[model samples]
Target: MPNDHHNAPQTGLSYYGLSLLSYLRESHPDLADDADFIRTRAQAAAEAYSCIIRSGGSRIEAAEEADTVLYRGLHFSLYGTLANVIRSEFADIIPEEDAREAALILLPQAREVARSYELADDFAATPQYALLYTELTGTVQILLDNGIQ
Candidate 1:
């Protein structure tokens, strides 16, 4: 929520949909793989967050409509695969489950973010793509430090 730098969704209240939703604002019917990733991650994150909430934890979906979408995409414009993006960027912040959660939160948005820019020598070398790739790393660190769990 609001990226308080202290209150990330640890078990149930993450703004997963909002993060991915921003990257997918555009349409590209030809890119089936990227589209699938975006769709799948968004749906899974939604369900996971919902499950956490239903079990009695508080939910913070309200932030989903605000800053989480528009302001964050400037960071992850890289071209690497989703796993590499997370591995490189979120090296220390994410644990096993957190990594899983982040993937669920990021896969789709990552695809769109990647597509927003063109790539070369593989998705990892493109400048614009690399920028966004590194941005996600920073975001993950922020989230982890704040307590995303």
Candidate 2:
């Protein structure tokens, strides 16, 4: 049989990354609108992938556990960063109530986007890995430029 995956381009993100970005931008414009928020969340997604691959070992249980732990860790990290940014940037400008409401509106959507990324295997040594990282961050940048996020 031919190597179906071999034809995959080495210098671009996998379809999964692109699709997730589109989903986040189209489904949750609020998260997409905040560049910092988007970047932080994208970093979380990338970190999750790294953790999954690093700690997965040869066991399925390990991979699953790593996924769970890293997902939660990165999620919390994103929230922590978000809080600090809001305090420094939005506290005096935007009313607390409005900021809270905006967060509520965007949090679930951001979580959904963050949760969509998963890794089945490690590709870190390959150009695809570079592409994945580039794509995730680039997606946010693209959205930012478009004023979508």
C-alpha lDDT (0 to 100) for residue 15 of candidate 1: 52
Instruction: Please write out the lDDT profile of model 1 over residues 102-126, one tens digit for every residue.
Output: 6656556555555656544344445
**Deviating ranges (above 4 Å) for candidate 2:** 1-20, 57-149
Cα lDDT, model 2, residue 63: 43
For candidate 2, the 10 contiguous residues with the lowest summed lDDT are 73-82
What residue pairs clash in candidate 1, if any at all?
A: 38-108, 75-132, 76-132, 77-129, 77-132, 78-129, 78-130, 79-123, 80-123
TM-score of 2: 0.28
Best by TM-score: 1
Query: Could you estimate the TM-score for every candidate?
Result: 0.32, 0.28
What lDDT does each candidate get?
0.47, 0.42
